[model samples]
Target: VMFFLFSLAFVQGVGSYLIQAGEDGSVTDDERDALLLWFGSVSTCMLTCFRVVTGGDDWGAYYDMLQPTGTINIIIFIFFVMFSEIALLNIVTGVFVENAMKLSQPELATLAFEQRKRDLADAASLRELFHQIDLDQSGKITAREWADIVETNEKLRYRLTVMGLDIK
Candidate 1:
């Protein structure tokens, strides 16, 4: 939008200059009227540019009308088309992508938090199982203790199997 407004202003400024630089440092009544009709009001210029940039209106008519004015007008029209359609569109796309990433951040965080909670629960379960297997309250399971517990405890074997540990 800013680029559109700036281009409109530039075209208006050039129109004003051309009007002032006419024959005898002044324009005829008809030419003055035509120039005024083309670049007189900001609202009109803005609507024209908006329509041209959005493809809502035919730009050939505008180009044809301004073609006789000078090369500067044609160049300004090209710049307006390039900046508004290409550059501004890319900027808008970037803003949308950035917003989408921001919106998904909480979901990503939630998934990470749930994964951490499952990991902590698994660790606690493993610790409890380790304590149960550590005979003589030694806080450690010797190979003999592990073998004896696995051989004697069916429930422990089932629990270890459920926990993805092979007792064999």
Candidate 2:
């Protein structure tokens, strides 16, 4: 069931991306191919993680809900959220890169590193990053460490200047 569902999601993601491209404008074959490849890669990664995390417990119920009919609403909801998120990220990345471009290399790297401080708090892949910044570990980062991490850019100074890393 999981395998079939994962396959269906991969096909659906590619189909949606192409339809989206066509709705915006004409998409070249190269663009279509690129979208398929990218979607397939990401789908594979997500499916792997899902399978690992859902090997038991409520897996049957969750898997049962993933039928094409049942999951249609969820798929649309996810598509909108993911699309808007990507668009926002593009905007933010462009703005930040442009702002950082004028700074010296040292300052630019510092700013970029600081920009990633929020990501460091991620309990998944970034746990190691948070640990490195935590200094004393204790499963949390101190205010001074957070300040050090996000002090480069004036914008993020106040946001990350807390008692400890905001781990969830």
Candidate 3:
């Protein structure tokens, strides 16, 4: 869907360029109508595309300008709106709802609770290991114990010093 929209954007860019290639940045009359449609239709911004389809802004002028682009382009343009805007969106929304419904509310809550319980247990186990590493029963783990128990890591040694633990 993303690829389709981007490729359509490029095609729309070329189509828009062909129509208003020689004109000024802004148009005043009929060309303005074409520009307005092109701006609203081929916009790179998703929100702008939504605005175009949802009638958040006037799209009648743009649709009218699609006339000179010929029958084939008009058909393609209509299909683009139908497929990309309507059908694809509904399919994605359906998939989301389906996935959400796969797990019941109680099951989801239990999974979350079990994860937190495991995390708390892991944290407590780490605190116990740290206490055991404090060989002298001092409140802090000294550098000597760190060296004896774990491989030397320069960053950890520096962190110990920063925490006011004397290496010696």
Candidate 4:
């Protein structure tokens, strides 16, 4: 199900770019330009597809491609919207709901607990993780050590819920 959505997004992204080629693809006064270069194609395609799917933004570039192409392209666009925007979105929603319904509340709690336990077991001990962060072997973590840890562990930077308590 995820693969289907990913494939659809890729196709739509390419379609969006191809259709909008006449317009400046660069960031201009009115529009934000894409950042970075190498992964831009796949990233922009996915972003454009996501925007179209969610109905957040549409510059009409994709539709504009139809202006010179005539009736056949219009038909193709209709199908693209139907399958990618409507059908795929609805199917993905249904799959999510179906999966949610498969597990009971108690079962979910048990699964969550088990997953947490497994993650903790697989990770380095809290003491060891902190020791690594304290590269100079100082008992206390300085600002540099803290910054180094946060930079290296992206997950920890995002998931720091406890202020006084430390966990790896």
Candidate No. with top lDDT: 1
TM-score of 1: 0.56
| Candidate 4 per-residue lDDT over residues 1-168, each given as its tens digit | 533455354445435654565375433322223311211355544565456556765626655533333455456555656667767778899999988887534577788999899668545555666776788887889987888788788666444543234444
How many residue pairs collide in each prediction? 0, 0, 0, 0
Q: Is candidate 2 or candidate 4 better by lDDT?
A: 4
- Per-prediction TM-score, please? 0.56, 0.21, 0.38, 0.31
Sort by lDDT, top down from the best: 1, 3, 4, 2
**Residue 38 accuracy (lDDT) in model 2:** 34
Best by TM-score: 1
Candidate 1, which segments miss by more than 4 Å at Cα? 1-36, 107-116, 128-168
lDDT of 1 at 119: 79
TM-score of 4: 0.31
Q: Write the per-residue lDDT of candidate 3 for residues 68-157, one digit (tens) a residue.
A: 545665575566556666766798899999888875456877989998997787667658767877889988988788778665556645
RMSD after Cα superposition, model 2: 25.9
Query: Model 3 lDDT vs. the true structure?
Result: 0.60
Q: All predictions: root-mean-square deviation over Cα?
A: 7.0, 25.9, 15.2, 24.1
